[model samples]
Target: MRLWLNRIGDISLREQLITQIIVGILCHELTPGQRLPSTRDLSRRFGIHANTASAAYRQLESEGWVELRHGSGVFVRTSRPNAPLSPEMAVDQMLGDIATKARKLGVSDAFLKARMRRWLALEPPARWLVIEPDPELLRIVICEMEQAVTLPVVGCGFEECSTSVMLEGSMPATLPSKVLAVRKLLPTGTELVTLQVHPVAPELQAYLQRYMPEHSTDLLGIASRWGDFQRIAQTMLIAAGFAPESLLVRDATKPGWKRGLDTTTAVLCDAAIQHDLPAGTRAIVFRLFDEASIKDLRSHEENLTTPDRN
Candidate 1:
């Protein structure tokens, strides 16, 4: 498995590895009995100390997530049938689970109690609150959601999500990349929807196959108000064998950002701002979400509005 580790981040390397492994297990990406990368391999590949990798694997084993075979490598713990639970045992187990989740979210006992009480009194979600770090990406997500579902869709940046009032009566949604970070800031028992991002690499490759021969020397433009999108597009193009000099990147956030984009053969942009490009400029629109995610959002809206007859 490929793991991305930041050596300079505030979180320790061992802890990061543990969290990522656990997340993979929970997401079903690491299935039961799957062998994990060896400590020596992790150390050599990631440039971390061997001791650090061993410590992380040890912690995971202690937490019941993996098992260390004496000679074989560590593997995910297989599932086992649970013993029958009495009524009182079941209740206690449920409460314990709640406490554990709350602690992870940094909620004090008092705050948990207060929030639980308030949640019991509140009605169902009236809208979606999309949390994204980039304002341009936020607008794109909100626009797509607004089109897919009937409920109102609003958005705020990561900094703005700190205000608790914004979460009231709203279902929180974010990109898959931000789920872990956003979950930490949410209250216990809050359900978060991970918005799906469209897969663009294949489309990019096809574009290259179809157009590269004729447009080899043409100046192709990558336009987006979001810096990350532009950077990612440029990287993918370069990796696909496009010459860096033949690419023109325009950040829509700057003044007169569209002034020179009309000169390019075609401008690749996110769906939200495609119409804003120069009238005659050809646009290769890359939508951020696929149809399946939009269908899921629509189903969620239906469930929320329809009465639970049962």
Candidate 2:
């Protein structure tokens, strides 16, 4: 049996082996009751640790894709008696067809596996947990995501998200900048989704384009508890030809954050902190998730609601 392994990618060698073998079986390249390579042979051929190969085989066996014979070797399971096609079989067929089409299009196995990982990551979790170190940003993310997804959305700091929450099958999401830190806090196999920073909303952009040149010398105050937002807003403003000196950025979490915004012509802040702005302050609400992100989120929610055939 031939197995493709991606050593430099996020997927472990064991998982790569298991996925490939399953694909092989589903594609009928490996017939039922066909003997598989020994763990030692697999280890040698794939240049993986012997233990990794053994673990892959063990997982395949536990999943009923293959069976291990004591003192002998592993083999694909023989056909069961008069059993209907299981969900697992259906999934395999679908995956096999996908692989065939992708191969025909000259797509490499590594690229296909990477795409698979991305889609798998999109699978809906039992709940959406927004992980933000700042309480205000956490609240903003939760509120925004709640509007975008139908699932229960909650917020927590990095430390507040305990192992129990992860064990409950929560999908922890965070800003792109904070993903690495969040991933380090989660258990292995936990999926960490990154919320993308979007450009200023279209209406806001239009307003800026229409009026900014007239008020080119006016101060543009930008406030948010999310550092990413502050930075993204600043970058976008500068890219739009707004003078850097005309921009006043603030981290709302800091003391006296509102001290300098009073002289600004307008303020841009996240919806969660909009209420904290001085009364009568002209504010343009900046959103983190854009239309594309929202569409992707809707797809994820659909995937979550779809019943597993297995």
Best by lDDT: 1
lDDT, model 1: 0.78
| lDDT of every predicted structure (CA atoms) | 0.78, 0.76
TM-score, candidate 2, is 0.49
Stretches > 4 Å off in candidate 1: 1-122, 162-164, 201-203, 212-215
Query: Could you tell me the TM-score of candidate 1?
Result: 0.61
Provide the lowest-lDDT 10-residue window in model 1. Answer: 1-10
Error (Å) of candidate 1 at residue 161 is: 2.7
What TM-score goes with each of the models? Answer: 0.61, 0.49
